[model samples]
Target: MHRDFAFIQTAPDRVFIGWGPFEQSPMRKPGRPAFYIADFFLDDPHPWRHPAEWEELTFDALADRAGDAPAPKIEWERMTLADFQPIFDSARAAMRRGDFNKIVPVQFENGHLVERTDLWPWLFRRLAQLPSGMSAYGYSYQNHGLAGATPEMLFASDGRGYRTMALAGTRPADRASELLRDPKELREHRMVVDDIIRRLAPFGNIEVETIRILELPGIAHLATPIRFEEIGIERMSFVEMVRRLHPTAALGMSPRTEAGERWLREADRGVKRRTHGAPFGLEVADHRALALVAIRNVQWHGDAIRVGAGAGLLPESQLEREFDELREKREQVKALLGLRASVAIEA
Candidate 1:
């Protein structure tokens, strides 16, 4: 029998709210969702939970549903550039220490504690606008919401095989050619690809498609799609694939590699992952799953609207360029929300 599902996650295993007559078992046999909307956390739980709470509802399509909801009530938070400098410095130090090959540094921005019922329709419509190669999602209940338009696909599998993208090396589209040639950007992009390939080894012979330039509205990335020829599905569960691939080098270097292990253990102490790089997955059909990274998402944590952005830093990275890259990321969200009081840190 089919069921319903919806959720907005912060990190770890807490939900803003959820309702489910889960059409498919989210952990194992979950089939396609009935208007399925779920979010995953970077803090993946080893032993999974059903997370089903209430019965499903008849969700309306965006065009018909958004008849004329009022504008969102936005309240800006207090923060600035001086506050984010330390994070960059620390990440740089770790790279120099040989403890990290790359570190994604994040900065928290001013909140836009929205008080409105229109957030759901707004977020959904905004998400729908993203073009090919991107996935958008939002979950709102009790009048608060969490949403993102993410370019990186964590993993997607149709009963036939498994595939994912190695997306890294960000630059504005105007610099696309420069990015493709730059040794530093190429090096960083390779690291992300290698991490994905290394982790997928157990699955099968990996066929890596030619790396291409992925152009987004504000930035472009070097993206490579990797397909596994054979998967040891009998011995693995869908979530198990998530466990093996997460904390990816695009965000956190994988601990399984010698260098990545040290980075995970010895790199910048006390700074938890800001975005957490959550892996939100869906069963498009029975046994077919598609998961995306929730990196570009914004959150409303009761008291504040939290937006964050990061750039992968390598020992060879330029602080000024890295800083500029992160600013672009943060600003994209700000512009998307039409918030006037955007905040920034120096490059």
Candidate 2:
């Protein structure tokens, strides 16, 4: 009698499930934080599907659901990059015209794997090496499955109030110091910080802590943490708290101005992002909530599987270098999946 469920793991021992037929967010139990997944797409005006539409069983339930047939063997096959050069070109033009201070351009590199083992056991082994900020996750319904690791924490509801961070400006960890004086990276990071402040100002009192560098296995980003107090129950539900801050300048441009909107529309090139940079959260028994940006993650839709990646585009961004960054990001994910594909990134 168990329905389908979504399971997420931040660490090897920490796993939680989202039992489904995911109804509504704001209307859920009062004082309790709702847990779900969110999606942001180019054409879809409102494309956030929290907890996904799949409802099934998990853990002991999945084993019970598994029939006598042996599961298919999973192997990562051919790699291909989403056509994003044109979008990058346009974003750079926008930056030059002062239309947008900073724009983040995203790309998807897709490949599929046929699982030879049970979902949970295989996933545990695959995600065993996640770096400090990355998280391992998997969601399946019927014949489809989505799984990967992401390092961005979009927002979390601390016991006292709400907390989120501005993560931008990617660079190799060895050369992270160069980011300090790099105008482009600093400008991009500032845009994220300023936008977070503007959106949270209306909620209540706000506080911002020191800005530092967040180091990852292969890359690093400028990070700043912000908190808001007295959110006032009336303004709290998912609509007020999440919708307002979604598509951050780090992921999408800000001010919701015509130029910024146009940049996203034209730059996106009609790609539908399933969970990359989307929001995912966990519900705490204590009534507190935790949410993280779904970047560096992949999803399964029917038969397709892909890992999502994006880079900030400023007027000074070099096209080839940005492309390289995307390749490096995608390669990092593939390596984690234990796939050694002979994929080469081109200019």
Candidate 3:
């Protein structure tokens, strides 16, 4: 018999599952490293229970569903540049000030439309469909209702062993088989790899791979895979490392605290209070957990979809090119939404 779980209805559409203690069964099963749970909030004008009540739900009830489930497939749609220029320009200025290196700006094309009944199942199904050799993975945050896929690994540890990546830079990719070999892009990627190596050395004897280029469905990235053996540290304690490395150079420059503050001042203007600021459902064990910078993401607002995208800017980066890149990224979502580019006409 399949395990039956009880979920606390937090909001009309949102349900909260209480997983047992953080220490129990931390590492996911092999080949099942990624996990997710979608909480749907029911539509109600008046609030129900206080937010604190939802935290009591336990995982003893939530179990993996059985059966061969198919992944949720996203249909491709076409979009254009004129629809995503303003946000790109804002990111460009941040880059010039050394506040951030890359900001994944996104936009919404259609309103909030959930094609799946459950988010966790949908996420696993999607992961199973990823082509082999695709090392990085990501998901949508329950609170924010945003989705993202990243090919970057900060670090993975299981007591004695660990692995991480330095991923940066980008190039356009039109086909799955194509490779990227751009020197300028490689240099940008190397900067991140170098930083991670230096910071992580004291904890372990680190090994670095020669920089290589990686391609995604829409872009190419320069990446360096890494491995290490812990010197004397316990496994679970390494969660701190993960926290320290977050919002990596791929997202912004070092001295991240100050940079993040500046970014909030500049880019967050008029932005709604949503889930983009934090990880959706994060848990750490044996020093194992994965999180991604909330970039190239979108949120559902009723029947309207909002997309976000952004670009990296160095002192030498061009504003026009930065703007164009963001526009290009947003087009991906627009195309997926089946909306005409003409709808972006200036009001």
Candidate 4:
């Protein structure tokens, strides 16, 4: 019997799925790389189950379970820092101009290869091999593939209630364990938590925890989890909450729309790469849509890899520190791709 295979494509209605070849990175020959399906999404009955389920199915186990599944086609391309610097600079300048606090800039490359059928399962197997501290999410859009292990909560809703957290501010530490002791970093994180609570006030009774330390693979982040209980309104769906909470101050400045526009305009003019304008894949449902901030992500196209990294810029933000932050974020992508050094930036 012929096996079934599908490629995630965006429709006119704005529905799409994006997967990177993360799991397959280590297996690919040097110079001829492959993209693991990092993210997968579909409207209504999501095509793939929760990421937890995917995690439980390992690569060897999956091969045994579905030996008949078809292979997926791969595409590849390279992204350079020379191409990204102007976009970063523009976002920084926009912050200086007070357009908004920060806006994430992203880029993608098309991987030009195709492998076995049954793409998601194969992709999931690869991701499952990663360390547990990594948070994996599946979205219903073809936005792009993200790799950064961020501690910020973009938006999450559990059918009845909705909650989101802001995670901004940064300090470099030689060890991830030191994040808990950094008072200055904690202060920056607090600013985000305080603002998110204020924004969710109209929805219902909201409770925010005090700042605490959260750790990912190579970094530690100041985290504050906020919870909300639905009040007068009927049970709120995930899409509804995302509409209100997405592009939060963590990704853009307060009054996000204005900040986004300024960064978009500047990035469009300064950067030679493509900017999809808005987040790519947006799935709306009566229940929920887990929207992830497309940060520290990269796109695979044939032999080339395009890595996206940006930092929050405040009036007090230093260019050198911001540069360091970008470097830290790029480290994983470099390691995954087996690249020794990252492309340097003039900024």
Candidate 5:
């Protein structure tokens, strides 16, 4: 099916689906809903789109429509440490040069579909199985698309107030305890939390909740919930809000400056991340939106499939460990997609 669609699970039972023929808009229509689709850099000038049709459906019904179907098999070329080394080295060197306090580098696995098969049903089936606390998101157009459940919500706003979280510092489920006390992980997580607060300082008085562990099937992350309820004199548009907080230290770099942003945009040149870590959100009503970070997703164009995993890097970051983390993330994503079984990490 050559269809264009976008969706996000607003609640455990309520999933909002929007399908195109979408009309691109410079500004969101009053009282109507729209989807804010953008790349990692928010490069799309007109990211707002009014879908042709939309509905809020139960998560169970959404999965039932797809029915029971087997996913297509494909030959996959997994990335090796050697393939990720150059990217990690570059990020680490940049940190040592005082260019950044933290930087995130991504690794990708490429594959080709072996036979003609419909991916939507398989994807929906997998998404329906996602655990609680994770929001499922997907977007597709023509022959290219992406879908997966994200553990991190970029932010959600009801016009006057907002809720977001700083999610970083990954560890295997077996080593979850290590994340609580590891200095390297703590420092990395702190950088993400502090940067988020600093950026939202002008918005209003912010409150940060106690740190907690967000556990998935095989991996876990340090998560800190944040609230931005009090508003200042200036009102920010959904697009502007996305621009301000996107690519937070968790996905981008610390001390987000114009120069640092430009550097990140150009890092690992030629690897255009169309939606990975991008803001993929749905505006449910006037001044209400749920934005999700597009991580842990599988992107496909025709027969070519791409899966990516990124890790935050610090000066003390070791290549071997970083590579292992990347592998762990990719495997977890694969498990989420029903591409493979969860691989447990030895403590």
Candidate 6:
């Protein structure tokens, strides 16, 4: 029987791969490693799974072994401003009502695979080619799964302490430097940084690094690295820490309180977010864990595929520019999936 498979880039050159006829549990088993996969809302209580087999290898070795198989062709129905305008309007109204200083609304491009294609080769090839600072990750179970190269780390730990980042504020890669002076982008970034600091403050002494630009294929984001040290952060359960910070202002609402949850419930658009912008993580040793924010990825169920991209909506956000930002992000995701290439597997 074919089992579920997942992989995460553990270092610049290293990747961890896991095969699962998994044992599910509400939390990580003592002295054992597990993968943590959850939806955007962190809805699953039993999100931890112990895989039957796992291994770590340098990405070059994986790429050398991944045969050259053509990627699938996809017929995508791109999203338009009209499709997302209503969600933007709803978020704006909530902001005006003081429900949130900022919120992220997502748009998706739905597609259909044109042929029967094996995704493993395409996925590993892309992983091997990822630029520095980006992590390649994927999880597939049966006919449904998601995969992407993401620059945002939700959090990472190794027993003694933890490290995370404030990743928000985006611009086209060409205008990356403008992020330093763009008032709206700067404001959005500060909200993410401040909110993360607030959440992690209770667990340890915090150190924040100067903000920098994280440039990817077609877009860039302002990112600030943060560390929590010497306050016994190990005492706090990993999942509890995830709960406290999963949807930091970067991908959720600002202020890190109950209000954000309430607003999310009220503005529910009935679209399932699946694993987009959720926490996808792994732990191979006790007290050592790594979690990546599941973004810049393509998700599929059977022959249907969806690419989702989200934009931060501030009171000052304009519909036209936000719409364009969504397009930029979607394009980056396509590039990562090799969907932007001219080659395809014939139906």
Tens digits of lDDT, candidate 1, 110-214: 555445334555554454445565666555445445677678877777456777888888888687767788898898889888888888786677889998999
What TM-score does prediction 1 earn? 0.78
Ranked by lDDT, the better of candidates 1 and 6 is 6
User: Which tens-of-lDDT digit does each residue in 1-347 have in candidate 4?
Assistant: 12222121122112122233222221222332121222211112222222111122333443355443333333333444565566567666766777765455544433332442223443434333444424333322232322232234455555567556666655443465565665545555665666677667887888787766555544556667788777876866434554466455555455455556556545545433332211222232333334444454444333333555546555565556566676666555444333333333332
lDDT of 2 at 187: 85
lDDT by residue for model 5 (59-146), tens = 7787897676786776777566678787888787777778887888776877778775778888887787789878898878888888
Considering every candidate listed, which one attains the maximal lDDT?
6
TM-score for each candidate, following the candidate numbering: 0.78, 0.79, 0.59, 0.61, 0.94, 0.94
Determine which window of 10 residues in candidate 2 has minimal summed lDDT.
47-56
Give Cα-based local distance difference scores for all models. Answer: 0.60, 0.65, 0.45, 0.45, 0.83, 0.83
In candidate 2, stretches whose alpha carbon ends up further than 4 angstroms from where it belongs are 1-3, 9-13, 19-34, 41-82, 114-120, 231-235, 284-286, 341-347
Model 3 Cα lDDT, one tens digit per residue, 187-305: 56666776676666777788888877676555666778888676775652333554455545665454354765555444445554233323223332222444334444445432345
For model 4, what is the alpha-carbon lDDT of residue 75? 35
Question: Which pairs in model 5 have colliding backbones?
Answer: none
TM-score of 6: 0.94
Q: Where does the lowest 10-residue lDDT sum fall in candidate 5?
A: 338-347
By TM-score: ranked, best first: 5, 6, 2, 1, 4, 3
